[model samples]
Target: MSLSDKIKSNPSFKKIAHWLMIPTGQHRPRLWIRMIVNPFKHKRGKNSIIRYRTRLDVFPYNHFDLGERSVIEDFSTINNGVGDVFIGDRTIIGMGNVVIGPVKIGNDVMFAQNVAVSGLNHGYKDVTTPPSVQKVETAQITIGDNVWIGANSVITAGVTLGKHVIIGGGSVVTKSIPDYSVAVGNPAKVVKKYNFETNNWEKA
Candidate 1:
């Protein structure tokens, strides 16, 4: 097998790698890794603004890319420890947002305050092990262009939100939403769909 594959197959090596990326007893990356490694491994587009107060728990093992002119406002937390986080051009990640990756956000997306987009989930099937200590699972969450995610909305794991989609405030999205739709409420359901011939949004 190739060297990278071989390393992954070994659990001890994987543990060591995790330790190097993260600290001894913390979820966040070590200072050295953040300062030295991530800058070289990740991609940051031109004119992208990641505010100074933002908590970036990004690691070098996974891809973390910000597209051109995208802005991540203050108090936002982005973690790419388990998977890639890609945000397209001119996207605005508003204040107090939490984004955990394996997430792909398209261009011109607008996220309001306190939105949480997380693909990382903790396994709780093992009764003997605490959920916090159990293995974590991830699924990709895809968000398309010109989407607007309202305040306090949550886009859960493996959910796909298509282009021109709108998510209402305080919604908990658990399933995939197709293009040109509006979803709301807990376990968010599409309440509106764009009718082509009528050229208006009608009830779904």
Candidate 2:
């Protein structure tokens, strides 16, 4: 098993590691951990630009990668505490976006302002326990090449957007969308698809 896997499987190790990385009852990482340790563990591709106002709540335990020429705009928040976050080359993550991993975004993707893409979900099945402290569930969210996500959209856990797909503004994507398709609305539905034969976008 990998070092991360081993640390996770061992309760004692996890507790100690968690304490070292994060301050008691705090969500943000310690200053030393962020300045000293994270620079070595996290990977930032060449030419990637992370805006000064962006908040990266990432730790060394989980992987975080930003591809070459990718840009994370101001007021955006990226957290990889629950899982890994991977962004491919030349992608633009717009302002005020919230991205929680395990999310893999492909190359040349475009995201408008205020988009929220999360792969982590809290488990509140137990009545006696508060959801905040309960075990969290995670699923990977995959976005293929050239996908475009509009403003105020939410891409929920386990959803996949195939290559060249487009998500409309204010949509909540709860399901997977196929390649070359356009999806919109809450619990987003596929409304148009590119037909290879005609090279045209036809209503679905």
Q: What clash count does candidate 1 reach?
A: 0
Estimate the TM-score of every prediction.
0.94, 0.95
Candidate 1: C-alpha RMSD after superposition: 1.4
Q: lDDT per prediction? A: 0.95, 0.96
lDDT of 2 by residue, 28-135 (tens): 788997789988999999999999999989988789999999999999999999989999999999999999999999999999999999999999999999999999
Please provide, for model 1 over 122-151, each residue's C-alpha lDDT reduced to its tens digit, 9 standing for 90 to 100: 999999999999999999999999999999
Q: Which residue pairs clash in candidate 2?
A: none
Error of 2 at 16 (Å): 2.0
**Candidate no. 1 TM-score:** 0.94
Let me know the TM-score candidate 2 reaches against the reference structure.
0.95
